[model samples]
Target chain A: MNPTSLAPSELAYVPFVSVDNMMKNVSAIGVETVMKGIADYIEEDFLRWESFDKKPRIPAHAPQGVIELMPTSDGKTFGFKYVNGHPDNIKDGRQTVTGFGVLSDLSTGYPLLFTEMTILTALRTAANSALAAKYLAPKSSKTMAIIGNGAQSDFQCLAFKTMLGITEIRAYDIDPDASVRLARNLATSGLNVTICKTAEDAIEGAQIITTVTADKKCATILTDNMVGPGVHINAVGGDCPGKTELHKDILLRSDIFVEFPDQTHIEGEFQQLPRDHPVTELWQVYAGQAAGRTSEHQITLFDSVGFAIEDFSALRYVRDMLPKTGYFEKLDLLADPDDPRDLFGMVLRAEAGRNGEAA
Target chain B: MNPTSLAPSELAYVPFVSVDNMMKNVSAIGVETVMKGIADYIEEDFLRWESFDKKPRIPAHAPQGVIELMPTSDGKTFGFKYVNGHPDNIKDGRQTVTGFGVLSDLSTGYPLLFTEMTILTALRTAANSALAAKYLAPKSSKTMAIIGNGAQSDFQCLAFKTMLGITEIRAYDIDPDASVRLARNLATSGLNVTICKTAEDAIEGAQIITTVTADKKCATILTDNMVGPGVHINAVGGDCPGKTELHKDILLRSDIFVEFPDQTHIEGEFQQLPRDHPVTELWQVYAGQAAGRTSEHQITLFDSVGFAIEDFSALRYVRDMLPKTGYFEKLDLLADPDDPRDLFGMVLRAEAGRNGEAA
Candidate 1:
């Protein structure tokens, strides 16, 4: 038997989407428009939450980092994301987070699409945050303080602008350059970006505050002292087991909302809370079975750790939009034949046919 | 934000490979060559199993079928499979098992490559069988009886021919058409194919017996009465829990070998054995730390429930090979920029730069 290492030249061609194309596509569609569409999709799927077979992410934790597979299917379309979180990745000249996913049909079990999901993840994560904010934030809310200006902060700003008509974004990161970078990136997005000196400055006077800092520790990016009444806190960074951003006291005071309680209990700010913590599954609010932010003066917190169903919506959108935008290439993945059973016959015939055609 | 509902026109431009391309690639190099190469990849990774963050599959069981994500990653490369099992899929004009996967660098957490793992799975599963067989079967093994000739049968024959120098394949399937199809597919693969009327006839005097059925039920493809001394049983069909191929009596009589004891215990023929069946991990044998096929007359059973590491090896090979094969197209999925943190800058600038240039 020949070892694959001995035969390294036999590779298969796969279409890829670089970040440049993602940005180009996002920019053309206008960040505002994309966010609105993504929020709609997320909202619509949340309404059909029961139709989905959902599970908490399966993570493989190694020394350097953790890789996870997040999957969900609603008996119609199935989607899953393979994402890795490596905090040390940036030091190696790489993003700390990257991902890609596949979408398939349940009727035939054939994969209908393949996509670069890294950028899509950021977009969808932001979209999900904004959608949660739409339901949980005060109706007249406009100002947002974004804590953490890494890969995801810009999307959070963009999503808010498109989904909620948010025009002002106050940004803060421990690293001054990140806040500066966030402001510079938003320079053209048309949103008023403010560089704040402290997390308190970012969240002060803001109706919706978003925490998306990346760290492996229980760092307090926002304290109860920094939060105000009727503030919708979108906590996006405390996703994994030990990584958290909020002061536990803040969560105790806020009426918290979550995507999936089972997941949020494990991955969201709720992880720090008791197993029986009083958190509402946000799907109910979308379904009208539960109340969102009951009053303009009440505080609401959306513990946004990202979910597989949101990826389902985003992947579906990307797959649908690629054709209209003419930005993607189909990958030769599923074997198609007049006879699916002739899998081997196809191979033999392909070999034989290749020879015959060559002759 | 828009939901993706792609028609063929939307995907017509995606990079595609006809079955002919895969055949030519395999034939120009040979199927055996591919199987052996994948085995080396699988073995090399297995030796460092502790380095991987491994997870049992996350399965979504529907009334008629099951969808699954099998994910694994070393600190360097992350990989996962989106696969489903529907024994009834063929009746619905679909293969029972279909899958695809991605390989990404952990440092940057970037998905470097993606490929259809359906056909690659068939190749890898078969390669896995042959790999285990090489470690368990006698060097003089020349014939393999493959009972249950469904979609995966052809690869089984190919793997044996390429890995163990198998010159003769005696095939049998309850559906005679499946057997006929298997024989016909392998007619030109340089291995002598024989159509047998019964499982007993196919297994008679053959040194290797492989079962690749698609039935979800625990049907005994091989019984205790049919067993012979010194033969190796490559059980492929009895993968899921409650699905068994070799009868308990046969397993009791044979020395069982497994890839991952934790998984194979639940999904492989080991399920038929006690919780402590005392099976040898195949890697220990490959590492020369354990005995393999201890004697000439020993009956060995390599109960393989496909593992993620095999897919990892196959996916890595395809990623490395596609570029050299000239069968790839670049997909703009990753949001790569001059500065990774300036993600939002990417799309905004592209849009503005393009608008300015057009003016």
Candidate 2:
């Protein structure tokens, strides 16, 4: 694209919101503030959930991992996120998750923003977890148990501290060093951190239990016996068919709430439940049309198979803050020709810059 | 994402091949040369089509237009294209299509490269159309007819000229100005251009007839009687379920071929046919596992519903050519902190660049 001429043309300048920009923004506002802001947006969006055109994310499972596309539109704008999960990536010293997405104008079908979604997903996932927990967890919850501390531990801690006023955190990971790292990161986070040896130890005396274990298998992060009646389970990371975090009996004991039932049925902990399993949509709860945790003693579980709207919220948040931070560089994602019909000619010109001179 | 330290990290630098870089690369190579190179890649990949993980491109159809994600992987590298088709986009003094895409390593699920695919798609689609005509058309064929003269017409005309040695192109569109624009763009393209008064006039004496009309409705650019014996029909524009470019009788008379059956059955001209409509897979024929034109007089049809593999090949080729050009701007798509565990700290540090401070 002739980037110079695009400004004067009818084209929309899609503000690129990269991970660096998002991080810079997070640092400027502080992690606690960003989480609170994201939670507020997620809550606001969830409240008007009837306005969104939602669907189960489209996933492509590969031999090594899985790639997914989550798309949603709220009448006026459209958004989608492209993400990949390969746990083995960490063995090669790379992050287990990476993602990016675009938000476009629904009327013109032109992408107005492109943002890196790796860090943003962690943030959004954590925000969504805390948002659900706000509605489902015990009212006076002061202590939270986090089982499986990998890439997602820090954000979860940040969100809980910002929203629920949690001052103490108990963390457990299969790898002891991971728990040690989690403790060290949260050391300056103004919260008391406990390095528990097991999920049972982490959940002991905790008001809210959050599981974010990443394994392709259906592992029991929280079994029936370990969970208490008044506790709320914020289930993350068990987001694919063969991957689930909780035991079936544990899910059977709780009054399940889900992001989207069609997706939760295939991906969430509810995958093990029967087709006839009764559950309420989280959107309805947000709308105040459906009851949430009728009593403080009711056991509640949020089957969070992350939705596209959270990504939309993150992209918007990143876009609003990118200009202040120079953490992003623009790629000529569009072909801006002097004349749109002369696309062939413009390409020939770009080729000249690459291959020395055009033949 | 410290862009400078990113390349040395275990994660691959998915240096986005920008639109400017792509256009420069194509222009330097010349449209004909790039088309020839892309045509070779398309034929080679199509022959091994079964090796790819194929799914019909997911499309979000709106009232005005459609946005789509075309993804395919070869178990080694994963690729996807983000494209939008808004026919009225041109009326607002804009290109009717724009796109970008990525090629990622499946082993680590790392995005290896991000590229501008709007111009690349035009070039690849044109190359694909010409490649199909090479096998389906008679070996001695020359003249071709292009029933649509919009933005795509230039690429289609020039690609055929370069790949198939089509010396003349007969062009026609409902809007005479579009045909005039197409003719002007191809003035230096070396092909003999004929601006015909009607579709019938354009198809006359043409060995290969390509219909690339760009309306959402089922508008027939070719009638059964207009197509003669031994003609290769390149059906380009009837890509969505409700859109078709060729008359039903035209399909009835020709030996049909498709990119992927599961996709073409829903989007191509085959949507007008029975569910069990007998059509040959193009890859099987390229692999010598199936037949092409059985007789010299047999009419052949390549129902060209664009496939993900074409975009995959195009993205891979651009990735190779990007390093040869220094015009690309590095995008911070991934976060690489000195400490991977301290993602939150990276944000804190990146924000230091604010207020004219060095980040």
Candidate 3:
């Protein structure tokens, strides 16, 4: 049993997209184009919600932050993301939320792709925000107030502009430097960007409000007095237990739509509301089974705790686009033996080959 | 925001051991030595079992196979293994089980090691069995009858020989070629091996019996008639629901010890017993809180469905051995921006760097 004599099939190689390749991929495909493509996939999957096996992200909480595993399957493929949120990671020069994901074939349970999702997560979060706005926001809306101008702000602005024809963004962050950074990044993004001094100033007269603050506490980034009628609030920041961005009064008045109620009740802005409070599943709205923004005076809120299915869709998109973009390296992730039952023999043969090579 | 200007700290590179490197590592350390080392770690972790956060492996079952995530933490570090069980994968030249794992810092939730676990899992599963046998098996046991001599058989033989001083093995498998394969692989080892044609013949004069057959059904590999007094049984293969290797009568007569009752009741041979059936936690036995092998005439069974804590210990062992073995590659798995909040800007700068290099 020589290792050199053992041959593995193509399934042994998993396409891996690193940060550099992911950047190149975004640049080659155009950020807005990729965002739109992912949004379309999200929409299609949402329409067939019954096909997906959905569960709340499994969290392991420590003193500093939380690490999570979000897994989902569509009977044909399985996908899961390993993500962590440590707001204080910035002090140590690490992203507040870093992620990686794997997609595998259901028939064989072999991983097809392994990828860095720090950037893809930002993209999918934005695409999901805009997709929600398309259904819940007031028609003819052209202005959005981004309250947290951080890593996610620029993508949120572009996604709205690309997916829903929003051309104006009023952005503000507690950290003025973050606002400046967002404004500079979006200077060429074809959106009229205004860096406001305060969240109140940013939300003034805007039809959509997106809050993506980074604190791990239940701080109110948006008050009830600041939100106006017919405005859609995309609450993206408060995504863990004891973390909420909007005041409870706002949730009490708005028609809350959520990705998954079981998860949203624990990690989303909806955590501030009562457990049995009325909320609509966003998939129902996307599928035309439920109403979204039914009245002009209704305040619509999408308590967007990101879901596993969105990561699944994003992975599928990247896997399908790999042939065209060529932005992946093959990784020898799985062990393949010539005879599946001879795994021990394979290792023994490999040992023999190494010794032979050394000799 | 230039990619060339952004500096990531030393934490950005994760030590990744691929299949090739893992093979080299096993050869470098010697299989029996690594097995003994992992068994030692498993025993140490079991002593402080209350310190770990344990959960049943999260499974996504399709019509053909199942994919699972098994995670555990000790308040300081978090470890998880992504594994799949596809019995029919052999038809496609793939192992019945393949796995990969991550070990991360609990303080920052950043992964420190990413390694292929197909080989590590084989080693750990065998080490776990041998470790349990040390407590439950009759004293001076020197021979083991291994009933399913496929992928796991060689490792089981070596682990027992290394950890429990077993010097002889009688192997039998439904597929006789698998038994021949196991015997062939272990030929050069110091232990004496005998290939038996039937399960009944294999158990003769053996003090321990290990059943690891790979059928996805409740087919009995060992019955009441096959059992002898004072012999310990290590049940390995029946790991999921609807899979069991021992007859109910055999289970009724044995003093069962399990890693975690909640999981074993669903996946192990205990699945055949009643819900309120009495069993001892192996940790209690190891920690001396409960009794193990109290009499020479008692039949003891270690119902060994794998647990997350074992994988955690295995990961910890591998991470510690990396500096000595140097059988790993550094993976650029995380996206580290100069400003942690500027993930998009990092990608944008990388794009700019690519364009600048081209120019």
Candidate 4:
């Protein structure tokens, strides 16, 4: 009746990347390089978009903010990000958006990586924005106007500079100090930074304009007259219902591109448009199944609501780099019994260990 | 232009309860006491279930198994459990189900605790079953027939003994070795145990029959003729679609009670019946809005598909016990920047720390 016990501590360990380690990894790899690596993974996943099981985020909404679970799988690997968006959190010295995520093996249903996604999310969001700009922006694009100089602004600037050879950065925020902070942070990024007093000034002669203002209500950061021809607008902050940055007129005039229509139609700038409005899936452009930016004068809008696949790609990238970077610690997250059916015996053994009976 | 830096490292740390600590906590509090505590919390939450934002689990199904996220919030607090069910995993020295959970402060969108839920789930599930039986079973019921002698078997045995004063257990498993192990694990407990050769033999004189076999198919673990009147069937095995442990004829005869009918209809034994089949919500019974057991001869079935509210209650219980037990470690899982807008600067600070300059 007594089953022989076996060691299972190793099976219980799951690699965990903490904020300190994530920052060290990013710093060691160089923020721009890590972002590029993540972007490449994203592009690779996007090219095989059909392989993924995608779903709209499951959200629990409250008065102060929203908490959401974004899960996606590529049949072999499963990944999900737990994120919370609270605009007023800044008053308490917390980021407006904070998150963490897990990546697991589909075959075993065991977690491969548990990591902080607050920094990773910022990086991946920028990488995704720049990736879309690469496909939708004019080939000669160089200057990028960043209309939101907040937590995500600097990442967007660096991603565009690294991914698209962007040389000029025009930054503007409702709070002028945010622009100043953005300029100072990118001082060593080698991009020419200019702080603008107005959104219009920030977009002057800019081929790519990224609007990432954080507000819970619909606000026009960019209007029809403000957006000219051949401009790729990356709208990143209209991520929840009743919250958007670009004017409805701009969306009507631009050729809209979205990550997942099922989601974007509810949370992105596309929410302003009718349900049946014509829009292109960005993965189609990555797969070369659909055209992107056919005319020089045609406006293109990347409704950057951020998707689950992008987080999955970022998680995969972090997991792949762990062996080389050694920036993660092993966590005893799963209970691995010697015999899976004898879980009760494991508890008994732990009790024995506690009582100095097991040696 | 440089924003003043503030201390935020403290804010980055979240309390994490590992598997080792979970076992220690369970052993320290005694398994039966922990189950009773979790059962009390389950009952308290069920009484006010209308306040919770309830949703069916978000599941990602694959060939090998399924991974799911069960999330719920009471407006002030948010909780979720990440669990996977892979029946074949046991063959590889892995559990059929393993889980971890997070409890967050919804007001701030910050996680209050992250803990291993594999053991906690076992305890909570058993407590939930016993609590349901307390409301549905005959007042004088003292014997429980457990058909599955697997990982969850011991917990169920202890829970019934602690919660309902059940003094005798009749255990049976397809694998005789499993039955032997179950008997060995509960040998120290003061409950009378009998190892049975057949499922029919196990339920011979038992007033409450619990079926918790692990199979991914439509299994006829119990037949209509086998179950006598006045018996409370605690069906806990068949949770996913296309999985049923009991026969359809037995289902038609018993008064079914379920947690979240929307989910039970798809995952519980109710999946076998028509969409409009009558069933009572278990929470309604807790809130005194519906009947549980009307007469001694009335057969009641607690279709335990497992719901988010139960997991939320378990998480709440664990978080409350952390300070007293001190069985947790701090995990730096969130990015806390000095200035909320200066997340990039936080990275720069980390870069400085990596370069041996920050100090």
Computed on C-alphas against the true complex, the DockQ of each candidate is 0.38, 0.55, 0.82, 0.80
Cα-based lDDT at residue B332, candidate 4: 91
Model 1 error, position A41 (Å)? 2.0
* TM-score attained by model 4: 0.96
Q: How much lDDT does each candidate structure score?
A: 0.77, 0.80, 0.91, 0.91
Error of 3 at B139 (Å): 1.7
Tens-digit lDDT track of model 1 for B1-359: 11121111221122333334555556666777877888788888878877877678887666677778877787677787778787777665556776666676654555666555667788899988888888898778998898888878888888888778999889888889888777777666788888998998998879998988877888888889898898988999999999988789998889988888999999988998887878998878888888888888899999989988888888777766666676555454554544667666655556667666667
lDDT per residue, candidate 4, A1-359, as tens digits?
12234234677899999988998899889999999999999999999999999888988888899889999999899999999999999998888899999999988889999999999999999999999989999998899999988999999999999999999999999999998899999888899999999999999999999999998999999988999998889899899899999899999999999999989999989999988999999999999999999999999999989999999999999999999999899999999988898888889987876576444
Instruction: Candidate 2: list runs displaced more than 4 Å.
Output: A1-12, A320-329, A348-359, B1-12, B323-327, B338-341, B349-359
lDDT of 2 at B65: 82
Error of 2 at A213 (Å): 2.5
Root-mean-square deviation of each candidate, in angstroms?
Answer: 6.0, 3.3, 1.6, 2.6
Writing each residue's lDDT as its tens digit, candidate 4 over B1-359 gives: 22234234778899999998998888888899999999999999999988999887888878899999999999999999999999999887888899999999987789999999999999999999999998999998899999989999899999999999999999999999999999999999998899999999999999999999998999999999999999999999989899989999999999999999889999999999997999999989988899999998999999998999999999999999989899999999989988987888998976765466444
Sort the predicted structures by lDDT, highest score first: 4, 3, 2, 1
Worst 10 residues of 2 chain A by lDDT: A1-10
lDDT of 3 by residue, B185-279 (tens): 99899889899989999999999999999999999899899999999999998899999999999989999999999999999999998879999
The DockQ-based order of candidates, best leading, equals 3, 4, 2, 1
Question: What C-alpha lDDT, on a 0 to 100 scale, does residue A273 get in candidate 3?
Answer: 77
DockQ of 1: 0.38
Angstrom error of the Cα, residue B178, model 1: value is 4.0
TM-score, candidate 2, is 0.92
